[model samples]
Target: MACLGFNPAKIRNQNLHYSKPSSKIVPSSKPIKIKPSPSQFSFKLHCLKSNSVSEAPLSPTEPQISEQEEEVDDPASELSFLDPEIDPESITEWELDFCSRPILDIRGKKVWELVVCDSTLSLQYTKFFPNNVINSITLNNAIASISDDLGVPLPEKIRYFRSQMQTIITKASKELGIKPIPSKRERYETVYQRHPGFQKGAKPFLTLDNPFPMDLPDNLFGEKWAFVQLPFSAVQEEVATLKRTFTFGASFDVELLGIEIDDKTLIPGLAVATSRAKPLAAWMNGLEVCSIEADTARGCLYLSVGISTRYIYATYKKTPTTTGEAEAWEAAKKACGGLHFLAIQEDLDSDDCVGFWLLLDLPPPPV
Candidate 1:
């Protein structure tokens, strides 16, 4: 654009050293692409209505505003105020900062949504509800109230449900005694002690082997396979990477190993939990549900370690202990205080693998 009140030829000649300004009008044979530099050009835009021109690169003597103009303030610079009604289920500032999950009453032939949100199971229900209140008692009542609706025992799962919801029948609403499911810390200690390989570490400072597993007296070729729990922080990345590594057709990965195994027969296998921040549901008899906070609970938490070739579910906490489970569970409950981190050793241990069998009975989800 030509600068107003200035000669176009003189300005073009001054700015473009390559182009010569001619008295005669001429068209170029080739298409010309010219991009003007900002600093080299100065222009004024005049408003036809106001008869005012805004000048670029104004001089010190130039006035910023005219006598006719009024100063205006930016509307965005001011803060906006709102008086929205607070949500009833929303957690107040005084309330504890905790997550909650929706109570899904699955006991009926058709699933029902409960009004109350169980904070313990809530973090898992974020996918379903935008906001929820955290109250376990309401959830407990919801499950207990549904017993009349339950006709036949549920397929494989509903029959196994017990912990907080275990009554001969669920119909009795009044004085519904909701038993406390074991806290995360207690469950881990109980499971760890009941595990034969981990029994040595139950009362520490004992002569537990370097691998820490105690082979059974009758069993030959004691299962060397074990597990080591990493801090819960790495659970997401490790689980994601594990899924990729264990994808079908993927080969043996030495990167996943806890220790180097020299023997060709001793190969390693691993299973990582996917929920890093997610609350895992600890199903009690398929009725009462307790929320197991990630990394805090021992529900299905297992990651394989050690020099074993065959994969076995023996080390898995889901299995009933070979011995003394009831006693360990009782003692662990007394010790729990809502916080725990397991003893760390470079070499973790696992049970000795025994001869296998085909699957018939599907294991129930632990509390």
Candidate 2:
């Protein structure tokens, strides 16, 4: 299989509307906008009947510190007051961001900072730096100091989403024997709220705008596809009891979204049947799929993935029937808090799926 480069010009259709985050259930007449930022690149392979999905809370001995640990003017001073005995469930993986904040320092320049936290956010460490000194070596030293001061073991992996900072982050992680993964699934840091610059409410310093949709490799295209839907209860039950060898992509408890998912509510989705099922599924597995969008006017379906990458996953000739299906998909997705799915199979008759991705257009974090 050949690795294809992302070419934005290939599918830059101006007719497509990029959605902004919204909470209202979009009517069929409105263009639904479900804007969620980057997602984690996590592909799982386990039997549906054999494996159970869940999130485990941090261990009991670990203190549940404030979501964002206290921040100070000086990075070095952080080590002085931090409880050396602070433990957070033996966290082995961390989310990292060494970026400028929405605030500025007394020097009339934006403050740069290195922020680190585990997935559950039970452990958080932050340090502010002057712009000139932001480098891999500085990052490496800060991480080392945090490890020594907290008596916590160094993480095995550090995940960061800012692609521009990949080189520096990778260099720092490699020097410390940690694997670095670029993923969009990092949570926004709330520590900035305490800063004076944000007291009046300011936009994030760094945000990935939605890029133009690109084309999938021609060879991996599916033969047949359709807009589909199923009751939420059926989908949830199948996920729990279905007999399957493997599945991958995003999965989370509906309760975590803060939106109630009524059992009988209909959930919209896309289903593809093709001889290239395995390969198509394989390619998608590598991506952090965000959500699927339908353009009723153009009669096309777009796949939103990674931090802000979009793809022309499929297109249909403009017809009333096709346009109606697209509208229904958009309307249903909006009704369900931007929840949707993608399923790949050899053909409609096949009892098993090559892949299934539970995609969501996540709402923006609270202010």
Number of the top-ranking candidate, with TM-score as the measure: 2
Error of 2 at 338 (Å): 2.3
Candidate 1 residue runs with Cα over 4 Å from true position? 1-164, 168-224, 227-231, 239-367
Residues 105-182, candidate 2: write the lDDT tens digits. Answer: 656566676667665544566566767787999999988887786667889988876766889999999999999877
Count clashing pairs, candidate 1. Answer: 9
Q: Which ten residues in a row have the lowest lDDT in candidate 1?
A: 1-10
RMSD of each: 33.1, 12.2
lDDT of 1 at 195: 21
The whole-model lDDT of each prediction reads 0.20, 0.59
lDDT of 1: 0.20
Candidate 2 Cα outliers beyond 4 Å, as residue runs: 1-93, 120-127, 145-156, 186-194, 199-204, 237-246, 257-259, 349-351, 363-367
In the range 122-202, model 1's lDDT, one tens digit per residue, is 111101111232244444343443322322111111211222332322222224432232211011222222221222322
